[model samples]
Target: MPESFHKPVRRPSSMFDTIFGGHDPADTARVAHSTAHALLSRVREDPEAEVVERLVAFTAEHGIDTIASLWSQAPARSLPGALWRIYLLQLMVHEDANTSSIIYERGRHELASADPIVAGAPTPAGPDEMVALADAILRGVFDGDFAVALNRAASFSRVEASGATHLADDYELTEPERSTALTTKALRLSTFAADLDAAAAHWRAGTLT
Candidate 1:
């Protein structure tokens, strides 16, 4: 498991519960939490609807507010929570980076390791594609294409295990260095999201407010 999602042995409630698990009841980040909970619940409650239906509902009903709200109310100093915030925020902006074809292949391998969802689920873009997409989105921010940042990251074509894929061909990694690539890819995406979040917060605080 990623350290960002560790299970502490000495907490009354899990970090998720304290930070973002159960619904907040106060209507602050409550719906955001509830939607997240419902996402999980639907996975177990009605796994069938958990796929496309739930995603549609989430995008339609709450939009990025539901996502950003989670970040806004996220525990200020929680590293794991911060990582989650970054991941969620990135998930929003990079929605287009669909790497389903590649993921279907890699996910089969990752399922036996860890993070079945991350490994099992599809990515719109592979590592390089995602990073390029992130750069484009960041550039959009500079260009004042406010909505561009909210667009899905980018789509990535399938990569072959024989090492013909973009990342495999462009970046060489030793056998022990494989995980490093995945981690690096995920972090780059997260950093782009965090940067966008920072800029938005700055604008809201400095001017909008």
Candidate 2:
């Protein structure tokens, strides 16, 4: 009789494959890119789009971890970078709609006497409007000029940060320091947005090495 033997079992390719079935980094990237592209296309095509919540839900349920995992290591001008930015924008708007609205309202009021406004950005008044503006901005990032979108977002963030600082200074309310702290974050985000804009510009100029 032939010696009884067991065929060797194949090991999983990666931890991801071991846990979530067999998918490698390339598969994850492809899925992330395709998922983002498809969802983004759906959002763009809807004339009366109200898909921000849906997009947020879908990303959280399906792709956030995978995309974020790879996104952290991607170069600024790469597809993963773009997808990460889009996901972040959506998640920010979704998770902090209330804070964004507060910041927007306070900033708008503080700037009212000076006619301060983001030139092309919408003046969002509440959570819904904030979500809408964010969606539109992300849409522009994909469908139009990426740099312009980044700059527009940066302008909005600057205005909001300015307003946040003004509120922190101008008011004597309970938790006055909150606005001050938020101002710091808003300003940091503004800088990041500006940096992204510069990167996009460099990419366009073919000088971004």
Q: In each prediction, how many residue pairs overlap at the backbone (N, C-alpha, C within less than 3 A)? A: 13, 0
For model 2 the local lDDT of residue 151 reads: 56
Each prediction's whole-model lDDT (CA): 0.36, 0.55
- Stretches of model 1 off by over 4 angstroms after superposition: 1-56, 70-73, 76-94, 100-104, 107-184, 188-209
Model 2 spans with C-alpha error above 4 angstroms: 1-60, 75-83, 109-121, 170-180
Candidate 2, 60: how far from true, in Å?
A: 4.6
lDDT of 1 by residue, 69-114 (tens): 4544544322222323334433332343344235434533433432
| TM-scores for the candidates | 0.28, 0.58
Clashes of 1: 13
lDDT by residue (tens digit), candidate 2, 165-194? 766665536666775565565565555455
What lDDT does model 1 reach? Answer: 0.36
